[model samples]
Target: MDFLNPNYKVRNLLVLNAAGFSCISLVVFLLATQPFYLSDVIGVPPEKVGSAIGTLGAVDELVAVIVAPLLGTLNDRINGWAWNHSRFPSGSRILELVSFSVLALSLLGYGQFATKLFPDLWFWRAIFAVGVSGCMSIVTVMLHEVNNSDFRWSHMAFWRTQFKNHGERLLDGNGELDTDNGGNNELPTVEDDVFRIEEGPTQQTNKKHGSLAALLGVSTGLGAVFSVLFFLTLPVRLSSWYPDLSSKESLQLSYTLLGYFSAVCGVVVVVFAYDCVKQRRLSGHTPDLELPDTTYFELLKQGLDASRNNLRIQLAYVAAFVSRSTAVATAVFIPLMVYKFYYNSGLCGAEDLQNSLKVRSDLPLKTSCYDGYIFLAILTGVAQTVALVSSPIWGILVDSKKLGSRATLAVASAFGMLGTFGLCLVGRGDVYDPRTATCFILVSLLGLSQIGTIIASMSIVSSVGQTVERTEHRVIGSISGLYSLCGGVGILVITIIGGRWSDHWVFGPFLLLGTFNAALAAVATRRG
Candidate 1:
C-alpha cells in the first residue's frame, strides 16, 4: 500500500489506472457475450459458432498486432508536444476521445446487425477491431508516460508550496527535503533491484513509484474480472428482473448500458488524464534521469541484437505470448464452453438447428439464455477472481529469492498444465453433479496458472530490460513492443485454431492451452 504512494496526487493515478481497466472491459464484454449474440441473435448454428468466434477473434487480434505498435509510436510522438501552445486538448486526448467513441458506438450495434452480420457485421467487427486496437495503444502510451515522466505533474511547484507552508530544512540535489537515514541511501545492487521484490523505506522514490506501473498491468485482469462478474451477466439479470423482455432485448439493453458506461469512462479520461512529460517539458522541467539521446531505430536495433542469442529475453518473449494468450482465451472460451454445455443439454436454444431460429423459436428463449448465462457467469467469475488474487503472488515470488523469474515461469507453466489438462480430461461434466466441484477446482487452478505466467513473463521482460538498458538507452520500449507484438500473435494463433477445435470438443481450447503451456514449460526448463 505504501508503494502506491507516487509523487503525483491520487486523482492522476486513478485516471491512469482507468486506461487498463477500460482496455480489458471493452474487450472482455464483447468476447464474453459473442456466443450468446451469435446463437440467439445472429442465428448461427451451435456447431459453427466456435469457428465464427475464432475467425472474428483472429481478425480482431490481427488488427491489434498491426495497429498497436504503430499507433503507440504515433501517440508517443503526439504526446511529445501535447498541449504545448493552444488552449485546446492535446492531439493524443482527441485521439482518445475518437477511439473510445468508436468503441462505445461499436458496442451498441453488436447484435442489432443480426443476420446482416455476414459482410456487414464483419466490416463492423473490423471497425470495432480498430477501436479496440486504438484503446490498447492508448493504454501502452499512458503506461509509458506513467513509468518515464518524472513521476510528478509539477516538481518545483510542489517544492515551492512545501517551502511556503513550512520552513524547509536541508534539501537534496534533486529538490525536496532529503529523508536521510545517516548514510543508508546508496542504490541497491542489480541483484536486489531485479530479484528482490520487497523494498525498504530508504529505497529510491522512483523505485517505489513502480507500484503504479505494476497496477497498470494488473488492470487488464481486474477489468476481465469486473466484466465477468458484472457486464457478462447483465443480460441475465435484466431478463430475470423484467419478464416481458426477450433474451435479445435483454442483450440489447445490456449493450446499450455498457456503451454509455464506456463513453463516461472516456469522459473521465479527457477530464482527468494529463500529459505528464509534455507538461514538464513545456514548463522547462526535466526529470532527474533525462531522456537518453536515443532514436527508435537504435532502440529497435539494440533490443533485437541483444535478443538474437539471449535466452532470457527469448524466454520473456515466449512468456509474454503465453501470458497474453492465456488471459484472452480464458475470457472468451470458458463462457463459451459453458454456453455450449447448456445448449447441448437442451437448457438453451432449440434441439434442432436446421429449421427455425435455433435459439429463439418456440422455446422459452429468455429463460434458456438466462440459464446459460448463470453457468457461464459463475464459472468465468470464479476463474477470473482467482486470477486476480494470484497475479501479485507470482510478482512477490519473482521478487523473492525463493524463486527466480525463470523458475517461476516454469512453475506457472506446470500449474497451467495441471489446470488445462485436468479440465480437458474432465470434459464439460454435469454442472449439477459432484463433478461440478472438480470443475471449480480446475477453473481456479487454470486462473492461478494464467496469472502466474503473466506475472512471471512480464517480470522476465523487466529483468531483461534492466540488463539490456545498460547497453542501449530507451531499449526497454523496443523490448516491450516486441513483447506485446508476440502476445498479440499468440492470441491470433490460439483463437483461430482453438476456435475451430472447440466445435468438436468443448474442451478443445483447454487442450490448446495445455499444449501451449507445456511448450512454455519445456522452453523455460530448457533455458533454465
Candidate 2:
C-alpha cells in the first residue's frame, strides 16, 4: 500500500501494468496447451493440429494490428473531449474496465462453448482473439501515454502543484525559497558555469523514461508467471474435481475455471482502480487536455509516413518484428517437438501407463515418456518463469547505460541463434533421443535467450518513442500502436508457414526460420 503513495507513483504504475498484462499471458498459456488438447483430447489428426493453432495465431495477431491503433486514436479523442466535458473525467478508465469485462466474458464463454462442442472451438477462438486483441492495444497505449513520455504532461505537473499547496519548502542554490519541487530549485544547482543548462528537471524525466524498457519487460514477464501457475495446476485440479469426467472433459472444465479467474480479476480492477493518468489531468492540469484537432485517419497516415521517413522508427519496427516472431515461433514449435519424441516412444499412447503410474508413482514420469502434457506444462512453465526473472535483469542492465542497447541486442541475438541451432539437433532421430537432463538444459537455454531478445527489443522501442516525440510532436500512443502492428505482422508471417513446416518435420521451422531470423537480427544490430 505504501508503494502506491504519490511519491512512489512509478511503483504503483508498474504493479497495475503487470496486473493488466496477466490477462494476455493467461490467453497465451491456454493457446500453448491447446496442441495437446486438440490432438489427444479432441481426437484431431496430428497433422492438422499445427495448422489450426497457427491459423488462429495469425488471425489473432492480425486483429490486434488493426484494432490497437484505432483504439489508441480513439483514446486520444476521448481524453481530448474529457478535458472540456468535465462530467466524465475518467474516460480511459471506463474504456479499460469495459475492455477487460468483454475479455473476461469472452474467455468464460469460449471455454464453456468449446468444451461442449469441440467442432465449434474455432468460433470461440475468434471471439476470444478479438476481445484480447483490443484489450491489449488499449492497455498498451494507456501505459505508454502514462509513463514513458519525456514531456511531463499532466501527472507530474499535478504532483508539483500538490507540493506547493501543501506548503512544502524547496531550496535552490541561489538561496530562493520555492514551494514546488518542479525544477525551480535545481536551476542554481548546476556547477558548470560554461555549459549551464536551463532545464533542471529534464534529467529527472529522462530517469523515469529510461526505466520504461525495464518496466514493460518486467511487467510482461510477471504476467507469464501467473500463466505458468495456472497451467501447472489445471490438469490435476480438473481431474480431481470431476472424477467421473474423462481426461478431455476434465481439461475442458479447467478452461471454464480459468475463465472465472480472469473475469474476477477484471472486475476487481474495474471497481478499485481509478485511471491514474486521467486523474492527474482532472486534478489540476485540465488545460493540458485540449489536444490538437486531428482525426484517426490523419493520425494513422502521419504514423505511416513517419515509419517511412524516420530511419530510427524503421529500425525499431524491424527489430521488434523479428524478435517477437522468433519468440512466437519457438513457443509454437517447441511443445510439438517434445510431444513428437514422447509419442514416438510409444508410452504416451499406452493404455496401462496410468495403471503403472498408480503402482509406482515415485518413478520418474519422463523415464517412460508418458504423460507428456505434464512435461510440456513444465517445459513451458520453466521457459516463461525464466522470462519473468530475466526480463528485469536484462532491462535494467540495458537501461543503465552500462551496456548499449545495440550491443545488448547483438549479443542476445547471437546467444539465441546458438541455442536455436542446438534445438535443431533435438529432432534428428530416435538415435539422438532426448534425456530429461538434455531436454531441461536445452529448453532453459532457449528461455534465457528468448527473454534477452524481448528486453533488448523493447528497450529499442522505448528509444524509438522518445525519438519520435522529439521530432514528430505526435502523441506517443499511435507510434506505440505501430510497433505492436509490426509484431502482429511478424506473427502472421511466421505462424502460417511455420505450422506447415511443423507437420512435415518437428524442428523444420526452428532450424530454418528461427535460425535465419537470429542471424539476420545479429547482423542488423552490428550495423546499427
Candidate 3:
C-alpha cells in the first residue's frame, strides 16, 4: 500500500505495468497449453486440434498486423496531445480503465458462453483471437503513455540548462534566468541550470520517454505472476472437473475462461487506475518534463524513414524473434506427436499405453514422452529467460565496440541450432527405457541452445538499432508485432504439417523444423 503512494509513483507504475504483462503472459500460456487439453481431455482428434490451433495462429497474425499500426498511430496522437497540453485533458487514465474493463468483460463472456455458443473449435478460436487482439492494443497504448511521461522529465532537464546559460546573460541587473523581470522576479535556481539544451522537439521529448520505458520494462517483468497463476489453474480444470467433455469442448471452455478472466482484469485496471500529472506554476521556464508535439503522421514517417535506413537491424530483430517462435512451436508440437502416434500406436510398453489411454479418457495425459517434452518446455523457458537477460548485457558490450554483432549472433545461433539438433536426436532415437535421466539431459541441452540463439539475436538487434539516430523507441511495438507475425506463420506451417506427419513418422517433421531454424539462424548470424 505504501508503494502505491504518489511519492512512489514510479514503483506503483511498475506494479500496474507488470499486471498488464501478466495478463498477456496468461493468454500466451493458455494458447500453448489448451490445444493439448483439447486432444487429450475432451477427445478432439490430434489433427483436428492442431488444425484449429493453426487457424487461430493465422487469424492472430492477420489481426495483429492490421491492428498494431493503427494502435501505434493512436498512441502517437495521444502522446502529441499530452505533450502540447502538459496533461491528459481527455483523461488518459479514464481510457485505460475503459479498455481494461472491456477486456475483462470480453473474457468473462468467453468463459460463460463456451458451453453454449462457441462449441465449435474455429468459432472459439476466432472469438478468442479477437479478444486478445483488443486487450493487447490497449496494453500497448498504456505502455506508451508510461514511457512518454519519463521522457518528458528528461527533456525538461535539458531545456532548463540551455535557458540558464543564454537567457541569464540578457537579464539587466538581476541574476535571473529569464531576461524579463516581469511581475515575478524569481531567478532560475541552480537545478534549472543543469538540464538545458534546445534542439529538435523529438530530442526534448526523449528524456522523459526513456524513464517511462524503463519503468514499463521493470513492471511488466514483475507482474507476470498473475499469468503464471492463470496457467496453473488450467491443468486442474482439464484434469478434474470436465473429464467427460470432448477435447475440443474442453479446450474451448478453457480458453474462454482464461479470456474472460483477462478481460475482466483489464476492465478493473482501466476503471481503477489513474495517471496524475502534477501542476506547476508557469515562469516562462520550459515545463521540466514534456513530450514532443510531433503529429501521428510525422512520427509514422519518421519511424518508416528510420527503419528503411537501418534495414539490417530490423531484419536481425525479425530473424531472432522468428527463431525463438519456431523453437517454441516445435516444442509444443512434439508432445502432441508422441500422444497421437507413439503412445497409442504400439510404440511403448502395452501396460504404459493402456494407462495412457485411461488417463486420456478422463483428462489430457502426457504420453511416456510427455515428461520429456514438458521437461524440454521448462528448460526452454528457463534458457530463453536467461538468454533474454543476457542479451542486454551483451548489447552493452557491443555498444562499447568490445564485441562484434556478427560474432555474438553467430555464437548464439550456433548454440540454439545445436540444441535443436539434440532434440532431433532424442526424438529419432529409442531411448525410452530410462526416460527420466535421458529426458532431463536432453531438455536441458535444448534449453541451453535456445538461450544462446535468443540472446545473440537480441544483442545484434539492440546494437544495430542504437547505432542509428532518430529511430529511438519509435515503432518498436509495430516492429515487434511484425517479428511475432513471422513466428506465427512458422508455427501455423509446422503445426499443420507436423500434426498429419506424426501419424506416419513422428520424429521426421521435428528434425526438418530444427534444420530450418538452424539455417535461418546461420543466415541471421551472417547478416548481423
lDDT, candidates in the order shown: 0.64, 0.57, 0.45
Kindly report the root-mean-square deviation of model 1 from the true structure over all alpha carbons. 8.0
Q: List, residue by residue over 1-528, the lDDT tens digit for candidate 1.
A: 122112233345567668668868868888888888887677787778898988888887787787655554444344333434334454346556677887878777774544555776676677787777676556544554444433442322332342231223335567666544121232322211222233442342233222433465467678888887888888888888998888878887887787787788888887767544434434444333324344445445665777775787788779877877786667777767777767666665444442454454554556655767767777777877777776666666666666667788888888888888887777765432212888888878877787777666655554442211243223444555566677888889889888888777767777888888899988887833
Q: Write the per-residue lDDT of candidate 3 for residues 1-528, one digit (tens) a residue.
A: 001101112333544565556555655464555455454444455546655554445554555456545444554455446546753632334444444454455444444443322254445445444444444444544444343322234333333354434554446666534533221224544333432222343432332322343333333322332333445345445635765654344445665666555655655564334342221112232232323465666666655565567755565555544454555443455444434444444553435666755644444332323443344345334433443344344434333344544554455555555655666666664423323455455544444444444434433333322211323444443433343444445555555565455445555455656665566656655532
- Pairs of colliding residues, candidate 2: none
Clash count, one per candidate: 1, 0, 34
TM-score of 1: 0.77
Ranking by TM-score: 2, 1, 3
Using all chains and alpha carbons, the TM-scores for the candidates as numbered come to 0.77, 0.78, 0.61
TM-score top scorer: 2
> Which of candidates 2 and 3 reaches a greater TM-score?
2
User: Least accurate stretch of 10 residues (summed lDDT) in model 2?
Assistant: 1-10
The sequence of per-residue lDDT tens digits that candidate 2 reaches over residues 1-528 is 011101223323544575556665766666666676676456666667777767767766777677766665665556556555655534345556666666666666655655422346655665665566555555555454434332332333333333222322334456567433421123322211111223443443354433555556666666665665665356665666666665566666667666777666666555444343344442344343334456667776776776777665665666666666666754677766666667666646444575755655543222233266666667766766766677666766666666656666666666666666777776576423444666666666666666666556555544444322253324445665677677777777777777777777766666665564575465556553
**Residue 198 in model 2: lDDT:** 30
How many clashing pairs in candidate 1? 1
Candidate 2 stretches with Cα past 4 Å from truth are 1-12, 87-95, 115-119, 149-200, 208-210, 270-292, 353-370, 430-434, 463-474, 519-523, 526-528
